[model samples]
Target: MQVFPYSIVAIFFIHHAVGLSFGSIFNDLKDTFSYYSSSLISEQCDKRWIPENITGLEDDLEKYLHGQDLAAEIIISALRSHLKKTYRKKPLVFTLHGWMGGGKGYTADFILKNWFLKGGRSKFVRKYFARKGYTADFILKNWFLKGGRSKFVRKYFARK
Candidate 1:
């Protein structure tokens, strides 16, 4: 028998109509010793999430984020009207700019959790950490070569 080592395990919540919630764990095993470069890891199909869970989300954002009411409101409004037919035509882009320890990351996390169906684990979301050891060239190379932008755009947003 072949032994497979699990490298990535992702859990997703499936809400059923019967008011029962279940968790799904997807275990993906890959061969790390191979000479191949940039092998496929874990990927989730992109899906839209309704922003009907706004009340709880607003409360959480208010509690966790201080002096960021305007930012929180903007994010929430964008999410709420993202799926509506009477919204803007272009894709919405949110930029959270701040110095270190200025709660930018925290606010971004809050937005992701509330706006996305699966929180930070949503397939529609992609996070890039701009820390030391990761330069623009390296980031672009990974984004292009590792099938990040092309594959995702083709698979998820190719239709509309």
Candidate 2:
């Protein structure tokens, strides 16, 4: 009779062990399936985080702009305001006449340093939004380089 009680205890132990092992296996399988369907890797990309390198608005366009959000907001606002008041259409050949050093370049650097989510051309970046209707404005013409050297102008500066 004592031996019979020991057999029952052994059966209870076996049942608990089998139930726990099976439950764990089922849970693991469920997790693996969920990971793939969620467009993420299970072990590889669990704790994904965005790097601190975006720049557009000092506030909005967070993912696309990777720098000082406030500066971009001011610049974009200023550019829009300037364009709104005296917007005009001119030929491709014009002058940056008085203004130089190119905030456009600095702007591009700022954007590139802060925003680039993926690989792309400059136009696809911050400039192309106005590039279509305003290509004639501010005089930054796109030029092809011959052997990647000559900056595509038909005439060179007098000193050069």
Candidate 3:
């Protein structure tokens, strides 16, 4: 007669004791591994930057932003084209310039709400403004002149 190893004997007894066949045990392990691997992949990936609703964004831009039809259309088209790529060499940057009451900030806020999962409250999104004490001159002198744009560009647009 052939002698069975301790592990083989233990496995045999455990299999019978647990009412599970070798195939079932292997299948269970495979399922568990698959679940854990997928969870790990999701955790490691950063997908917050992807826009969630492009069509809704386009519609909202058109409906809410009065007298800015061309701007809305251009923004939607540019965003759609940029986001369709599998790999991006650089982040898409939009410079919204107009009169003080031209709804630039409103448009930005709207886009942010539609793009991010947490909308404007997302931790990945940062908003810098020239508030009460911080005037435009102060910001220009401190931030724009002192390589702040470079730092901002590196953090958001550059490859890690």
Best by TM-score: 3
Q: Ranking by lDDT, best first?
A: 3, 1, 2
- Better model by lDDT, 1 or 3? 3
TM-score of candidate 3 versus the correct structure, residues matched by position? 0.55
Model 2 lDDT tens row, 28-107: 55654565556332212121311114324333444444544665566555544543554344312211122244244444
lDDT of each: 0.54, 0.36, 0.62
- TM-score for each model: 0.50, 0.22, 0.55
lDDT of 2: 0.36
Error in Å for residue 120 of model 1: 2.0
> Could you say which candidate leads in lDDT?
3
- Between candidates 2 and 3, name the one with more favorable TM-score: 3
lDDT of 1 by residue, 7-116 (tens): 21111222233444332222111223231223223342323342336677788888988888888898788767764645454655676776778777777676666655
- CA RMSD per model (angstroms): 13.9, 19.8, 12.8
